[model samples]
Target: MHAWMSEASLDRADNRRKVPEWVSAQWRRPGARLLLVDSDGQVATDETGSGPAGVPTSGNYNAQLHTFLGLVDGIPWFTTEGPIIGPSASLRHLGAVTGGAALELTVGAVALTAWHRLEPHCSGCGARTRATAGGLTRRCPVCGRVQFPRTDPAVIVAVIDPDDRILLGRQSSWDPGRMSVLAGFVDAGESLEQAVHREVFEESGVRLREVRYFGSQPWPFPRSLMVGFVADSVSAELTIDRDEIEEAAWFTRADLAADLAEGRVIMPGKASIAHRLITAWQGRLLG
Candidate 1:
């Protein structure tokens, strides 16, 4: 798994049929801390510290701002619905998450914010939706329709051939000779395994088999889950789809090392699952 997607120690208590009653009674709990964040998942902190120890939830927010982000270590956490409010909070972006308990909190907050931002109307009848399940659900009063947040799934794979060479490709938008594994969105009614084979073949014209699961990552730039895999190619024939891939190649470990040493090939960033998957395979397969 990519370091950013590693598990953080948080108990969201998602199975609770109703919002915790304690959310309404947190003020009486002497040690309770209600985390406050704006639409961007940024939390206000004490001017002196990096931690969100001084976030004020009352000065500029009300009940409407609340997005109950389940319990963390028995203390309640809440995210606000308006513009980003924190001056000192950290921002976790694609491929960059300094894992701590707070990273999960930030990801959860941001995912919810995206749900609220992107979906305002019920899909069933086009009625304006309102929060009903402590912001976990958006319900329509006019049509009795309910909506939930969406997390789009995608597949990313590294293809290998009989000689143990890795298959990598470059897209038109990338810098020259910069190559990474092939990836694409999983289409409707398609299994993940099917998506992997379909995407790899579609982009590079390579037949793949022995598709195996590698790892997963949450790329929440907007909202995407990157599923990783490693597969073996049935043959090594180049049929580049100029519209999709600019170039494709098979690389032995030495080929990769030479290009990397000469600054001809740039690997994916460390924060990505692609980098991790490639690194893992290189360590196990390299002579």
Candidate 2:
């Protein structure tokens, strides 16, 4: 399972968030904590660099700069943007070292911070929006339209052939040794299964049959939800789409293991759904 899907430790308290008094009370409660995130989606980490460097939610914090991040163990948690005096790390690195609620909280904090930062205006009308409902929503005064956080859906799949070989591809922008499973964003008026077939064929000319849902991951790299799937390929053919994929190929388990051991190929990191999907197919973690 993805790191963000850990056992629940934070209660979002969606119903109570509607009450301004309650949200304010959560902010002022003892043990209230604040997490700081930069525009690049990196958060300040503790001295150990294993967890977020959270400070007390004190002083007169501007409501626009911070939002409620739910509760951990009945203690309120808030997220804000600001400068800090310590080491900072991206969710990619943090996801590797942290797990459970700590990782979940950090992911939530980063996603919320990015949403509030990028979406401060109304999409319907050209009007500025104000943070409301403890930062879960924004309300435009001119149009009176409320906007919720946006999450774009994308699909990532592992294509297995009749011979039990998995297909992987390398994007042109990546290093020579880097490769991973095929993935693309879902289009309008399209279903998840359609997306898997289209993306696979477009990238590698591999027709798919019997596509099955695997799982999902909250890929908050600028707010995206990655839906994972596994599909059987009709045939193994090399038809690389140089536009997005620089090269494509099918590899058996033995070939993949040898390439990985010899430093000839690099798989996705543990932080991504692609990594999890590939690991599941490979029957073990990739080196």
Give lDDT per model, in order: 0.71, 0.86
**Ten consecutive residues with minimal summed lDDT in candidate 1?**
54-63
* Tens digit of per-residue lDDT, candidate 1, span 1-287: 22644555666656551453544454335454555555555555555434444243343323344666666677666665454343545443322434455656666676776678778898989988887555677889899988878878999998988888898889999998788989999999999999999999999899986898887877665688899988988998868888988888999889998999999999987667778777877887422
Model 2 per-residue lDDT tens digits across residues 171-256: 99999989899999999999999999999999998998789888788878889999988899888876888997999888888999
Model 2 worst lDDT run, 10 consecutive residues? 1-10
C-alpha RMSD for every candidate: 3.8, 2.2
Q: After superposition, how far is residue 139 of candidate 1 from its true place, in Å?
A: 1.1
Would you list the clashing residue pairs of candidate 1?
none
Clashing pairs in 2: none
In model 1, the runs with Cα more than 4 Å from the true position are 1-8, 26-56, 59-63, 81-97, 175-177, 285-287
